[model samples]
Target chain A: MKVDIVVDARYKSCPGPLLALAEAVMKASPGQIIMLLATDPGAPRDIREWALNVGHKVLNIEKADETYQIYLEVSS
Target chain B: MSKISIIVASEKLDKLLPAATLATTAAVMGWESEMFFTFWGLLALKRDYEPKEVSSDYKVYEDYLRRAVSSGAMPSWLEILEQGKKTGRLKVYACSATMSFLGVKTEDLVEYVDGVVGAASFLSKAKDSDINLFIS
Candidate 1:
Protein backbone atom coordinates (compact mmCIF):
# COMPACT_ATOMS: atom_id res chain seq x y z
CA MET A 1 0.00 0.00 0.00
CA LYS A 2 2.96 2.31 0.50
CA VAL A 3 3.90 3.35 -2.99
CA ASP A 4 7.39 4.72 -3.43
CA ILE A 5 7.29 5.40 -7.14
CA VAL A 6 4.59 6.17 -9.66
CA VAL A 7 5.10 5.40 -13.34
CA ASP A 8 2.67 7.15 -15.64
CA ALA A 9 2.44 5.36 -18.96
CA ARG A 10 -1.17 6.12 -19.78
CA TYR A 11 -2.00 6.35 -23.50
CA LYS A 12 1.09 4.31 -24.28
CA SER A 13 0.50 0.93 -25.90
CA CYS A 14 2.01 -2.48 -25.32
CA PRO A 15 5.71 -2.45 -24.41
CA GLY A 16 5.49 1.18 -23.47
CA PRO A 17 3.78 0.59 -20.17
CA LEU A 18 5.84 -2.49 -19.48
CA LEU A 19 9.05 -0.81 -20.48
CA ALA A 20 8.36 2.10 -18.20
CA LEU A 21 7.66 -0.19 -15.29
CA ALA A 22 10.76 -2.23 -16.01
CA GLU A 23 12.88 0.90 -16.00
CA ALA A 24 11.44 1.95 -12.69
CA VAL A 25 11.98 -1.46 -11.23
CA MET A 26 15.62 -1.29 -12.14
CA LYS A 27 16.02 1.86 -10.09
CA ALA A 28 13.82 0.75 -7.23
CA SER A 29 15.12 -0.61 -3.99
CA PRO A 30 13.98 -3.98 -2.81
CA GLY A 31 10.50 -3.77 -1.19
CA GLN A 32 9.73 -0.47 -2.87
CA ILE A 33 6.24 -0.23 -4.29
CA ILE A 34 5.61 1.13 -7.77
CA MET A 35 2.19 2.07 -9.07
CA LEU A 36 1.75 2.15 -12.85
CA LEU A 37 -1.00 4.09 -14.55
CA ALA A 38 -1.74 2.79 -18.02
CA THR A 39 -4.64 3.35 -20.40
CA ASP A 40 -3.83 0.61 -22.86
CA PRO A 41 -6.37 -2.24 -22.66
CA GLY A 42 -3.62 -4.82 -22.47
CA ALA A 43 -1.66 -3.17 -19.68
CA PRO A 44 -3.00 -5.17 -16.78
CA ARG A 45 -2.38 -8.60 -18.26
CA ASP A 46 0.90 -7.50 -19.70
CA ILE A 47 2.07 -6.15 -16.37
CA ARG A 48 0.98 -9.29 -14.61
CA GLU A 49 2.84 -11.49 -17.05
CA TRP A 50 5.94 -9.33 -16.94
CA ALA A 51 5.96 -9.30 -13.17
CA LEU A 52 5.68 -13.07 -13.13
CA ASN A 53 8.55 -13.46 -15.53
CA VAL A 54 10.79 -10.97 -13.76
CA GLY A 55 10.05 -12.05 -10.19
CA HIS A 56 8.20 -9.00 -9.03
CA LYS A 57 5.00 -8.92 -7.03
CA VAL A 58 1.75 -7.52 -8.35
CA LEU A 59 0.01 -6.11 -5.29
CA ASN A 60 -3.32 -5.20 -6.84
CA ILE A 61 -5.03 -3.88 -9.97
CA GLU A 62 -7.86 -1.39 -10.11
CA LYS A 63 -9.71 0.06 -13.06
CA ALA A 64 -11.12 3.56 -13.19
CA ASP A 65 -12.37 5.62 -16.11
CA GLU A 66 -10.85 3.32 -18.69
CA THR A 67 -7.42 3.44 -17.04
CA TYR A 68 -5.67 0.77 -15.06
CA GLN A 69 -3.83 1.36 -11.81
CA ILE A 70 -1.42 -1.47 -11.20
CA TYR A 71 0.50 -1.82 -7.96
CA LEU A 72 3.78 -3.70 -7.89
CA GLU A 73 6.43 -4.45 -5.33
CA VAL A 74 10.05 -4.60 -6.34
CA SER A 75 11.99 -7.73 -5.52
CA SER A 76 15.63 -8.28 -4.69
CA MET B 1 16.63 -18.88 -18.86
CA SER B 2 14.40 -19.52 -21.84
CA LYS B 3 15.50 -18.47 -25.29
CA ILE B 4 13.67 -17.12 -28.30
CA SER B 5 15.13 -16.97 -31.80
CA ILE B 6 13.50 -14.88 -34.49
CA ILE B 7 14.29 -14.85 -38.18
CA VAL B 8 13.26 -11.58 -39.73
CA ALA B 9 12.78 -11.68 -43.50
CA SER B 10 11.05 -8.43 -44.40
CA GLU B 11 11.82 -4.73 -44.20
CA LYS B 12 8.19 -3.68 -43.90
CA LEU B 13 7.15 -1.70 -40.84
CA ASP B 14 4.36 -4.07 -39.93
CA LYS B 15 6.57 -7.15 -39.99
CA LEU B 16 9.40 -5.49 -38.13
CA LEU B 17 7.10 -4.11 -35.42
CA PRO B 18 5.85 -7.50 -34.31
CA ALA B 19 9.25 -9.10 -34.61
CA ALA B 20 10.83 -6.37 -32.53
CA THR B 21 8.05 -6.47 -29.99
CA LEU B 22 8.41 -10.19 -29.47
CA ALA B 23 12.18 -10.17 -29.32
CA THR B 24 12.30 -7.23 -26.93
CA THR B 25 9.57 -8.62 -24.74
CA ALA B 26 11.42 -11.90 -24.45
CA ALA B 27 14.60 -10.10 -23.47
CA VAL B 28 12.96 -8.04 -20.78
CA MET B 29 11.42 -11.17 -19.40
CA GLY B 30 14.89 -12.48 -18.57
CA TRP B 31 15.05 -14.71 -21.61
CA GLU B 32 17.82 -14.92 -24.12
CA SER B 33 16.53 -13.35 -27.31
CA GLU B 34 18.29 -13.23 -30.66
CA MET B 35 17.16 -11.91 -33.98
CA PHE B 36 18.72 -12.71 -37.35
CA PHE B 37 17.82 -10.13 -39.96
CA THR B 38 17.92 -11.77 -43.36
CA PHE B 39 16.85 -10.74 -46.84
CA TRP B 40 14.85 -7.52 -46.84
CA GLY B 41 14.84 -7.40 -43.07
CA LEU B 42 18.51 -6.64 -43.21
CA LEU B 43 17.70 -3.25 -44.67
CA ALA B 44 16.27 -2.13 -41.37
CA LEU B 45 19.72 -2.39 -39.83
CA LYS B 46 21.21 0.01 -42.33
CA ARG B 47 22.36 3.26 -40.88
CA ASP B 48 19.72 6.01 -40.97
CA TYR B 49 17.23 3.74 -42.71
CA GLU B 50 13.74 3.66 -41.35
CA PRO B 51 11.16 1.24 -42.68
CA LYS B 52 8.14 3.45 -43.27
CA GLU B 53 6.03 1.25 -45.50
CA VAL B 54 4.03 -1.81 -44.63
CA SER B 55 3.60 -4.88 -46.78
CA SER B 56 1.77 -4.18 -50.05
CA ASP B 57 -1.54 -5.58 -48.85
CA TYR B 58 -1.44 -3.41 -45.73
CA LYS B 59 -0.65 -0.15 -47.49
CA VAL B 60 -4.05 1.26 -46.64
CA TYR B 61 -3.30 1.09 -42.90
CA GLU B 62 0.25 2.40 -43.07
CA ASP B 63 -0.84 5.87 -42.07
CA TYR B 64 -2.79 4.47 -39.16
CA LEU B 65 0.30 2.69 -37.88
CA ARG B 66 2.42 5.78 -38.34
CA ARG B 67 -0.08 7.88 -36.44
CA ALA B 68 -0.02 5.47 -33.53
CA VAL B 69 3.74 5.86 -33.31
CA SER B 70 3.66 9.60 -33.77
CA SER B 71 0.87 10.08 -31.28
CA GLY B 72 2.89 8.23 -28.61
CA ALA B 73 0.47 5.32 -28.48
CA MET B 74 3.13 2.95 -29.77
CA PRO B 75 6.87 2.99 -29.60
CA SER B 76 8.82 2.83 -32.84
CA TRP B 77 10.17 -0.63 -33.62
CA LEU B 78 13.72 0.58 -33.13
CA GLU B 79 12.84 2.09 -29.78
CA ILE B 80 11.47 -1.22 -28.66
CA LEU B 81 14.62 -2.96 -29.81
CA GLU B 82 16.74 -0.43 -27.98
CA GLN B 83 14.84 -1.00 -24.76
CA GLY B 84 15.58 -4.69 -25.04
CA LYS B 85 19.21 -4.00 -25.70
CA LYS B 86 19.43 -1.94 -22.53
CA THR B 87 18.73 -5.08 -20.58
CA GLY B 88 21.81 -6.77 -22.07
CA ARG B 89 19.82 -9.91 -22.82
CA LEU B 90 19.14 -9.48 -26.51
CA LYS B 91 21.47 -10.15 -29.43
CA VAL B 92 20.95 -8.83 -32.93
CA TYR B 93 22.66 -10.40 -35.90
CA ALA B 94 22.66 -9.34 -39.53
CA CYS B 95 22.65 -12.02 -42.19
CA SER B 96 26.01 -12.29 -43.91
CA ALA B 97 24.55 -13.50 -47.20
CA THR B 98 22.01 -10.70 -47.29
CA MET B 99 24.72 -8.12 -46.76
CA SER B 100 26.56 -9.33 -49.86
CA PHE B 101 23.41 -9.59 -51.93
CA LEU B 102 22.24 -6.14 -50.93
CA GLY B 103 25.77 -4.72 -51.11
CA VAL B 104 25.62 -3.58 -47.51
CA LYS B 105 28.94 -3.32 -45.71
CA THR B 106 29.49 -3.60 -41.99
CA GLU B 107 29.79 0.15 -41.74
CA ASP B 108 26.36 0.50 -43.27
CA LEU B 109 24.73 -1.19 -40.27
CA VAL B 110 23.64 0.60 -37.16
CA GLU B 111 25.93 0.29 -34.16
CA TYR B 112 23.61 -1.98 -32.22
CA VAL B 113 24.09 -4.93 -34.54
CA ASP B 114 26.04 -7.54 -32.57
CA GLY B 115 27.54 -9.22 -35.59
CA VAL B 116 27.04 -10.51 -39.12
CA VAL B 117 26.56 -14.26 -39.32
CA GLY B 118 25.84 -16.94 -41.87
CA ALA B 119 22.91 -19.36 -41.80
CA ALA B 120 24.89 -22.21 -40.34
CA SER B 121 26.22 -20.08 -37.53
CA PHE B 122 22.84 -18.61 -36.73
CA LEU B 123 21.23 -22.04 -36.78
CA SER B 124 23.79 -23.49 -34.43
CA LYS B 125 23.24 -20.62 -32.01
CA ALA B 126 19.47 -20.84 -32.28
CA LYS B 127 19.15 -24.61 -32.12
CA ASP B 128 18.67 -24.66 -28.35
CA SER B 129 16.07 -21.90 -28.34
CA ASP B 130 12.82 -22.64 -26.61
CA ILE B 131 10.86 -20.70 -29.20
CA ASN B 132 11.58 -20.00 -32.86
CA LEU B 133 9.71 -17.49 -34.97
CA PHE B 134 9.99 -16.51 -38.62
CA ILE B 135 8.57 -13.05 -39.13
CA SER B 136 8.23 -11.67 -42.64
Candidate 2:
Protein backbone atom coordinates (compact mmCIF):
# COMPACT_ATOMS: atom_id res chain seq x y z
CA MET A 1 0.00 0.00 0.00
CA LYS A 2 1.00 3.60 -0.49
CA VAL A 3 0.14 6.63 1.54
CA ASP A 4 0.90 10.29 1.12
CA ILE A 5 1.20 12.09 4.45
CA VAL A 6 1.35 15.84 4.57
CA VAL A 7 2.68 17.41 7.74
CA ASP A 8 2.16 21.17 7.87
CA ALA A 9 4.95 22.22 10.14
CA ARG A 10 4.84 25.85 9.24
CA TYR A 11 3.07 26.86 12.41
CA LYS A 12 5.06 27.87 15.43
CA SER A 13 3.12 25.58 17.78
CA CYS A 14 1.91 21.99 17.89
CA PRO A 15 3.89 18.79 17.40
CA GLY A 16 0.95 16.39 17.60
CA PRO A 17 0.49 15.90 13.87
CA LEU A 18 4.04 14.72 13.29
CA LEU A 19 3.91 12.34 16.21
CA ALA A 20 0.64 10.91 14.92
CA LEU A 21 2.13 10.22 11.51
CA ALA A 22 5.10 8.40 12.96
CA GLU A 23 2.85 6.27 15.11
CA ALA A 24 0.64 5.47 12.15
CA VAL A 25 3.55 4.45 9.97
CA MET A 26 4.99 2.29 12.69
CA LYS A 27 1.69 0.48 12.91
CA ALA A 28 1.26 0.13 9.17
CA SER A 29 1.88 -3.12 7.36
CA PRO A 30 5.21 -3.76 5.73
CA GLY A 31 5.83 -2.78 2.09
CA GLN A 32 4.01 0.49 2.42
CA ILE A 33 5.38 3.62 0.87
CA ILE A 34 4.63 6.85 2.67
CA MET A 35 5.24 10.22 1.15
CA LEU A 36 5.65 12.89 3.79
CA LEU A 37 5.44 16.59 3.18
CA ALA A 38 6.95 19.02 5.63
CA THR A 39 7.80 22.72 5.66
CA ASP A 40 10.33 22.77 8.46
CA PRO A 41 13.92 22.99 7.21
CA GLY A 42 15.01 20.29 9.61
CA ALA A 43 12.53 17.70 8.35
CA PRO A 44 14.56 16.21 5.53
CA ARG A 45 17.76 15.27 7.29
CA ASP A 46 16.00 14.51 10.55
CA ILE A 47 13.47 12.24 8.90
CA ARG A 48 16.08 10.62 6.72
CA GLU A 49 18.25 9.83 9.70
CA TRP A 50 15.30 8.54 11.72
CA ALA A 51 14.23 6.25 8.88
CA LEU A 52 17.72 4.91 8.60
CA ASN A 53 18.09 4.31 12.32
CA VAL A 54 14.78 2.47 12.58
CA GLY A 55 15.07 0.19 9.55
CA HIS A 56 13.21 2.25 6.99
CA LYS A 57 14.46 3.32 3.58
CA VAL A 58 14.34 6.94 2.47
CA LEU A 59 13.51 6.44 -1.19
CA ASN A 60 13.63 9.97 -2.53
CA ILE A 61 14.05 13.59 -1.46
CA GLU A 62 12.82 16.44 -3.65
CA LYS A 63 12.53 20.13 -2.93
CA ALA A 64 10.42 22.71 -4.69
CA ASP A 65 10.33 26.28 -3.53
CA GLU A 66 9.59 26.08 0.22
CA THR A 67 8.34 22.51 0.46
CA TYR A 68 10.00 19.11 0.83
CA GLN A 69 8.96 15.71 -0.46
CA ILE A 70 10.29 12.70 1.43
CA TYR A 71 9.52 9.16 0.33
CA LEU A 72 9.87 6.22 2.67
CA GLU A 73 9.56 2.46 2.22
CA VAL A 74 8.72 0.46 5.28
CA SER A 75 11.07 -2.51 5.66
CA SER A 76 9.96 -3.71 9.07
CA MET B 1 9.20 3.58 9.85
CA SER B 2 8.56 7.06 8.57
CA LYS B 3 9.38 10.69 9.26
CA ILE B 4 7.83 12.79 12.00
CA SER B 5 8.57 16.45 12.66
CA ILE B 6 7.70 18.17 15.92
CA ILE B 7 8.11 21.93 15.92
CA VAL B 8 8.28 23.82 19.19
CA ALA B 9 7.73 27.58 19.22
CA SER B 10 6.86 28.52 22.77
CA GLU B 11 9.31 29.23 25.55
CA LYS B 12 6.94 28.56 28.42
CA LEU B 13 7.59 25.35 30.26
CA ASP B 14 3.89 24.54 30.37
CA LYS B 15 3.34 24.93 26.67
CA LEU B 16 6.50 23.11 25.66
CA LEU B 17 5.95 20.04 27.79
CA PRO B 18 3.20 18.62 25.61
CA ALA B 19 5.32 18.57 22.49
CA ALA B 20 8.24 17.05 24.31
CA THR B 21 6.00 14.40 25.83
CA LEU B 22 4.51 13.49 22.49
CA ALA B 23 7.87 13.23 20.80
CA THR B 24 9.33 11.08 23.56
CA THR B 25 6.25 8.89 23.60
CA ALA B 26 6.49 8.30 19.89
CA ALA B 27 10.13 7.38 20.25
CA VAL B 28 9.40 4.95 23.04
CA MET B 29 6.84 3.29 20.81
CA GLY B 30 9.60 2.53 18.31
CA TRP B 31 8.73 5.30 15.90
CA GLU B 32 11.40 7.60 14.57
CA SER B 33 10.92 11.11 15.91
CA GLU B 34 12.43 14.51 15.17
CA MET B 35 11.75 17.62 17.19
CA PHE B 36 12.47 20.99 15.57
CA PHE B 37 12.80 23.67 18.24
CA THR B 38 12.10 27.02 16.71
CA PHE B 39 11.32 30.53 17.93
CA TRP B 40 10.90 30.70 21.68
CA GLY B 41 10.89 26.93 21.99
CA LEU B 42 14.63 27.03 21.46
CA LEU B 43 14.95 28.71 24.83
CA ALA B 44 13.98 25.49 26.50
CA LEU B 45 17.12 23.99 25.06
CA LYS B 46 19.35 26.55 26.63
CA ARG B 47 21.83 25.18 29.14
CA ASP B 48 21.17 27.54 32.04
CA TYR B 49 17.46 27.11 32.74
CA GLU B 50 16.27 24.85 35.53
CA PRO B 51 13.09 22.80 35.62
CA LYS B 52 10.38 24.64 37.46
CA GLU B 53 7.45 23.14 39.30
CA VAL B 54 4.36 22.82 37.19
CA SER B 55 0.71 22.73 38.18
CA SER B 56 -0.89 19.58 39.51
CA ASP B 57 -2.68 18.96 36.25
CA TYR B 58 0.69 18.98 34.56
CA LYS B 59 2.17 16.28 36.70
CA VAL B 60 1.95 13.73 33.91
CA TYR B 61 3.84 16.08 31.70
CA GLU B 62 6.44 16.62 34.37
CA ASP B 63 6.70 12.89 34.92
CA TYR B 64 7.00 12.07 31.26
CA LEU B 65 9.66 14.68 30.70
CA ARG B 66 11.44 13.44 33.74
CA ARG B 67 11.40 9.85 32.53
CA ALA B 68 12.67 10.92 29.13
CA VAL B 69 15.75 12.41 30.74
CA SER B 70 18.92 10.42 31.39
CA SER B 71 19.00 10.40 35.17
CA GLY B 72 15.56 8.80 35.26
CA ALA B 73 14.30 12.19 36.41
CA MET B 74 13.86 15.57 34.89
CA PRO B 75 17.07 17.46 35.53
CA SER B 76 15.52 20.51 33.99
CA TRP B 77 13.42 21.27 30.95
CA LEU B 78 16.61 21.39 28.95
CA GLU B 79 17.82 18.13 30.35
CA ILE B 80 14.51 16.42 29.74
CA LEU B 81 14.50 17.19 26.03
CA GLU B 82 18.20 16.46 25.77
CA GLN B 83 17.62 13.01 27.14
CA GLY B 84 14.93 12.48 24.55
CA LYS B 85 17.53 13.12 21.88
CA LYS B 86 19.93 10.64 23.41
CA THR B 87 17.60 7.76 24.31
CA GLY B 88 15.58 7.72 21.14
CA ARG B 89 15.91 8.29 17.43
CA LEU B 90 15.16 11.96 18.06
CA LYS B 91 16.88 14.87 16.36
CA VAL B 92 16.55 18.46 17.56
CA TYR B 93 17.16 21.63 15.57
CA ALA B 94 17.37 25.23 16.69
CA CYS B 95 15.73 27.82 14.51
CA SER B 96 18.28 30.08 12.95
CA ALA B 97 16.16 33.19 13.03
CA THR B 98 15.19 32.70 16.62
CA MET B 99 18.73 32.06 17.65
CA SER B 100 19.87 35.29 16.06
CA PHE B 101 17.02 37.26 17.55
CA LEU B 102 17.73 35.89 20.98
CA GLY B 103 21.45 36.32 20.50
CA VAL B 104 21.86 32.62 21.01
CA LYS B 105 25.21 31.47 19.84
CA THR B 106 25.57 27.89 18.79
CA GLU B 107 27.69 27.39 21.84
CA ASP B 108 24.92 28.78 24.03
CA LEU B 109 22.55 25.91 23.23
CA VAL B 110 22.56 22.64 25.05
CA GLU B 111 24.38 19.68 23.55
CA TYR B 112 21.24 17.89 22.32
CA VAL B 113 20.58 20.06 19.28
CA ASP B 114 21.57 18.68 15.91
CA GLY B 115 22.08 22.05 14.21
CA VAL B 116 20.84 25.58 13.73
CA VAL B 117 18.88 26.46 10.58
CA GLY B 118 16.50 28.98 9.06
CA ALA B 119 12.83 28.37 8.35
CA ALA B 120 13.48 27.89 4.66
CA SER B 121 15.91 25.10 5.33
CA PHE B 122 13.63 23.53 7.88
CA LEU B 123 10.67 23.73 5.53
CA SER B 124 12.61 22.19 2.68
CA LYS B 125 13.76 19.35 4.86
CA ALA B 126 10.35 18.74 6.43
CA LYS B 127 8.45 18.86 3.16
CA ASP B 128 8.60 15.11 2.77
CA SER B 129 7.87 14.20 6.34
CA ASP B 130 5.05 11.78 7.09
CA ILE B 131 3.86 13.83 10.02
CA ASN B 132 4.44 17.44 11.03
CA LEU B 133 3.46 19.23 14.19
CA PHE B 134 3.73 22.76 15.55
CA ILE B 135 3.70 23.00 19.32
CA SER B 136 3.21 26.32 21.03
Q: Residue by residue across A1-76, what tens digits does model 1's lDDT show?
A: 7889999999998889998899899899999999999999998999899899999999999999988999999999
Chain B, TM-score, each prediction? 0.98, 0.74
Candidate 2 lDDT tens digits, A1-76: 3565444433212233234346557566677777776665766776766676567888887888877777777786
- In model 1, state the lDDT of residue A74: 93
Off by over 4 Å in 2: A1-76, B51-80
lDDT of 2 by residue, B1-136 (tens): 6667888877666666667766665564456777778876887778876545444566767655545443422233443355456555777889988888889899988777788887888887778878899877
Q: Which regions of candidate 1 fall more than 4 Å away from where they truly are?
A: none
User: In CAPRI terms, where does candidate 2 land?
Assistant: incorrect
Interface RMSD for model 1 amounts to 0.8
Which stretch of 10 consecutive residues in model 2 chain B shows the poorest summed lDDT?
B70-79
Best by DockQ: 1
Q: A8 in model 2: Cα distance from truth in Å?
A: 38
Candidate no. 1 TM-score: 0.98
